[model samples]
Target: MMKGFSPTKYILKSFKSGKEFKDEGWTLDAPGEMEPSLIRAIYDKKQIDVKDDSWGLYKFADWLPIGRVLEGSSAPVTYKSEGLAKELGLENLWITFSGYWPEKGTNMSTCSFKETEAYSVCGRMTPEMDKVLVVASAGNTSRAFAKVCSENNIPLLICVPEDNIGALWFEEPINDCVKLICSKSGSDYFDAIHLSNIVAGMEGFVAEGGAKNVARRDGMATTTLSAVTTIGRIPDYYFQAIGSGTGAIAAWEANLRLIEDGRFGSNKMKLMISQNLPFKPIHDAWKADSRHMLPLDDDLARKQVEEIIAKVLSNRKPPYPIAGGLYDALKDAGGDVLLASNEHAHDAARMFLELEGNDIHPASAIATATLIDAAKSGLVKKDDLIMLNITGGGEEKFKTENELFYLKPEIVFDINPGEDEVIERVAKLF
Candidate 1:
């Protein structure tokens, strides 16, 4: 039997590589990077300091370890989608699948990495203050956080685009303890983000500042840590779908810590990040080899991306231009970026299911497409260790529940409506 949980080793000790920066906030001290630090600070018995207390919350979870593959295997390795890799020339790769439909018999729950983030973020919260935690999601994140908050009885105010509310798993409503807010016109994820900031300005509520939250970053970083621990080292490359590119950033951070532990692999992992086609500003920028990208003015392009086969990976303003952004991470890591069309994503998904017999999420298929492109272009070596992050899957599980997750239509307003009118509508929620 396994021994009692060890928080020290899993969290406190592992965060030793943490550092703080003025502009970039707290970050891990990744090797060969120009950023300040990965971790802000650490808190332990008998002492507390400013650097460590930069963020209000300071707890961590010993999340589940990296899953193992089935050689002669037992228990059918949950989240291990074998067919997905072979279809993309990743025969000897590991799929760090998150989101819905874990092989462990859990149906597609909230359908996001938010579950992983919430488990770790909430583990850091305390009962001293009634934290009205605010989170914005296109769909999956709100659901994931709502489920975690409901089970933990954590007060939460979730914000999402009205049009995207239809994407939420309506079968599981936000817990009664959690309040929901929908942006006007069902704008995009950015609209919900703006709404979240407005809500955060209110009393008793705090915004879980997307990628800025250390808990959120580290929580997602667990994916990389799990992969390293399980595979016993960092791979030659890391591929994942990104909205904010936070997961990629997390992997960069975690790899640094693993290096410090001196037991994991080198700090030489390549980052291969991808965006959905039609509206991929980041991919376009990466391809152009430019530091910045102009926002797409093409309505058709935006529509195609918004209505993409893999809508979850779409982001209007990813953190690609900021300091220590996706571009920098990839450049420093000697990485490559790619864009996958809806057809490519769809075909990849189908191919993966047929070959590996695992139904991968559409976003994951985009990453799978990139892997194929890498193989054909000779960007990947035959024997190089690779880790493909299956961001989300298990859409079929939603059908079994026989119900749709929907949100109540809240107030609707213009894109940047009058602040007074917005404040009044928000005041009603409290």
Candidate 2:
């Protein structure tokens, strides 16, 4: 552990039962049978003080549930927007960027905000813990975690859909401590998750816990912290594109923390989260005002997932309906789910490049598309304080400056492989 960094700075609290416990490697459940809920990090510090001496996201270490700061990490960049704000006719618009833009001092090498989760989750691991950490992702997330664990020499096993294997490209060769696996071709994010769950059950491997991990959520929450700290107040509206809606929920959680801090004004920002059209499960559920997601046909869901341009936003089983999840966050934060068509998203991507001078991920494009609609339709007033979260960007720029190396899967499995076969095969990789 790093000097002066306390593992006891925060306690894990159940969002449903309000029970608190100490960090015990990978604890995702409460003491007994109860309603399903996310466990949260309740930090000891009520007012967050940015650490000037710390690097990257560690500057916000007061709230992040990390024992040690990792090298090569960077904080999200927040700046008052001049170009996109002018184009949208909004007066108080702030943009928080989470990807590579060395000019702005943002350096997430994977070109995705998922780096935030990777850094914190990996940081939470102690040297005493020798278990292999398992992660399941569609694309961007696997890339981020792979990059971080490879650099840090942390043992990691990554499972991603074979269709998204293209996203595994990196600037440098990955270390052998990190291993890659994939679900069969034509599989979706959920299939990748299924494979990961099977691996996590085996001995010597541990699940990364997805949205259930407080460290992951608190890491992603730094975007909101960056925005609010930079803007000096919480914006009236917060916009982002969601895959699992984890980041949006992170924003809402950060909003609650800021309100408690008593420095930033006590106002909850409306989370105007968007999903790509034809694959908007969260949007569909929100529209129907249902806590539980409406039944979606498996074949139709897989087909819809393939149709969306923003492939990273294709989580079939998002944490929307669970306690202390997206549904509850949306209700508390006063927001509505929005959808963005492929045409509009592409146009928005082009507009951002032309106006903002940066290439963004397709998911970020979908978020910008929704913001444009909201501005034009008077959902936001001309002077309303707004923060648009550019979840990922600068991939084109990064690629131009660096040679790319794609990671190859050591093992591949069908969507629903036999558990014993999986365990036997995956165990050999180590």
Candidate 3:
């Protein structure tokens, strides 16, 4: 269990009851079976709360509190991936990156796109909420949320894989509001998730559901919004690599908003979701055209995907086929699915570095590989408005400023454990 200082405020709301955001708004409805209307309704009804002054990092210069770009990034356009353009055979391909690399811009807070999601989520947290307890099963999201919470002094408790602590690279050390906890030995992200849920259910803690949280969905969705706004139109096709598939879902929601905004584009954009090799259940299931997927349920499949070494993109059980699953989202968008092996991802990253002169994280490399494959297969046109969401990059950006970061699993749980230890830990926090 993880304990942290109490926060002075707490904010809660749903997608439906937001403060009447009306800039060419689009309805972010999940598929009929996987409808997010309940959350959206909450947001619409003002159930979800945010500070009146809260504004996300993605807001244009006109909206930023400082009225200046972050230190490293000069403009959003430079962050977009360029190597992907030539390979895709598209004249106008764009890759929007967020980080502290001088070539683009330094999201000096580190963890790249994860910061994008965290900042947006925090911005929406009204002062009414004393604190926010975010359950991050992975290092990226954990570091991201921790960074934001530290900066804002928002009490945040992060639950992550025991093995992932001490391993993450960060823009800086976390603040007092941020606390990291891991499960016992043999525990993974899922186990921490279960434990985090129990604690959140207790008094004064709000659980930031990983993929299910609308703030995360909307926050990640801003990549697309930035794209269309920068280019003045929605690309004919949008693509990204997925771990939990939330970013893709966020893109879908953003597209809907763009359509509603009307100035960017009135039509829906086709989505192309990519999976790294071996654990590509979503890709395989989509190719099979099966509405439902039978679990691979084999360690071998997991290992095979792990060999690709793009560990961040590995989500054994992606939300697919169950209403808001990957399959349903792609099908509704008239999109396609792509799978890339580790070899492919690495090669693409190498080629991109040479062509575009920028280093990209391995997970995002998977998307670049898919773009190349799609072009070679002639699946996309040369002139299509193709936008590749380079979710992260600039591994070397902070090496000069600080040392590398790492994750060290704190506890070792065989499986589920008795509640006594967890309860005791929680009690100590107050």
Candidate 4:
């Protein structure tokens, strides 16, 4: 049995405080919810050890701030993609794939890395808060939470945009506790978030903290742990595509932990996070060397979000520029943001499918495309060890092999809905 398998304390990054804490309730460290903050797990290293192949994500349970492991191989699968390496002409290339590809044993039914956050956050909840867990997503995040909630018989409420309803698919029958509320066509991801927040305030509902959740952040850090344990060392560069940029922050935090663990080489890994063109607020902010994002004209941002192929990367208000947020993560890792256009994403997706024999999510394609740009621009040397986080993939094969049971919306509302009846309608789901 793994000793010290559960985290002992929660450290608030912004406050520079490391206090022993419990797993229940909201884990973010700010005095008030309005002041944004992030927290992490601090383990008892004397009893903790990340054993190799230790039954999925539980391998890093010592660091994950959850009560129990969800019954599945929830950790990301990491491997050195030789064919992709040879094609990209980089001598050392690792791919951390997080999606359904049973042949390789990476079975994320939602087909996105969002499931990592879902597992940890769901497990972190206190039984006292028997109220339903509420999550807002464009598609992947909500679908991930819904499937997991159904599997575990945990009550959950998913608020999502209507157009992306086609994205929510489950091989098994959904449980009654999983209720989906989708907004109309013009209602984008932010609309879904707005609605979810309103519901969160009402009785019998608890908000699933977005980037602020400690379990969610540490859960994502497993990707880095998976890579380090597999490769026996950290890579020179880390690549990923971000919406809320939480994953990149997770990677940086994981790197820091690994450095403290003294197993992986102590050198800092450079983050090469990317975004889809025309709608890249975080990317634009990084380019200007500014902590804050370029002022967003909501209408313009929405239009750009529509134009981008990677709809999952269209989070309007990301965690960037906040204290101990994405900006700090990038600064700590000596990282920079890269831009990938639609053409780049399309070409890269084709290249990945041909080379790796698996279909990747559009956001993952954008990350691969960013790698291509880096290789072409001489930003990365041919022999540099690189880790490409194929954040989501295997859609084509997954769809062909399994039956997709699309989840129907329990309630559909108009754009930016503000009726008191909406809250009453959601309350009835419990």
Q: Which candidate's lDDT is highest?
A: 2
Q: Please identify model 2 stretches exceeding 4 Å from their true place.
A: 1-8
Compute each candidate's TM-score over C-alphas.
0.80, 0.98, 0.79, 0.94
Q: 273-371 in candidate 2: lDDT tens per residue?
A: 999999988898899999999899888999999999999999989999999999999999999999999999999999999988899999999999999
Q: Which of candidates 1 and 3 reaches a greater lDDT?
A: 1
Over 1-430, each residue of candidate 1 has an lDDT whose tens digit, in order, gives 0133233222222222343233222122443445432332232221111111111111123332111110110111124345655545555577675545544433336555566667655654545546588888877778777777876678888887777776656455556677777776536777777777887788777777666556677667766765676677778889887777878977886676567667765666898888887667777778888877765764554466566777667677776776555666777777877788888888878876777555677788988888877877878876778888776766665456567655564565566566677678867765
Q: Candidate 4 — which residues are off by over 4 angstroms?
A: 1-24, 32-35, 46-48, 51-54
| Cα-based lDDT at residue 351, candidate 4 | 93
Question: lDDT per prediction?
Answer: 0.63, 0.92, 0.62, 0.82
Superpose all Cα atoms of candidate 4 onto the true structure and report the RMSD in Å to 1 decimal.
2.3
Better of 1 and 4 by TM-score: 4
Ranking by lDDT: 2, 4, 1, 3
Please state the error at residue 361 of candidate 4 in Å: 0.5
- lDDT, candidate 1, equals 0.63
What TM value does model 2 have? Answer: 0.98
Mark the regions of model 3 whose C-alpha exceeds 4 Å error after superposition: 1-38, 41-84, 106-108, 184-187, 290-293, 298-308, 321-325, 404-412
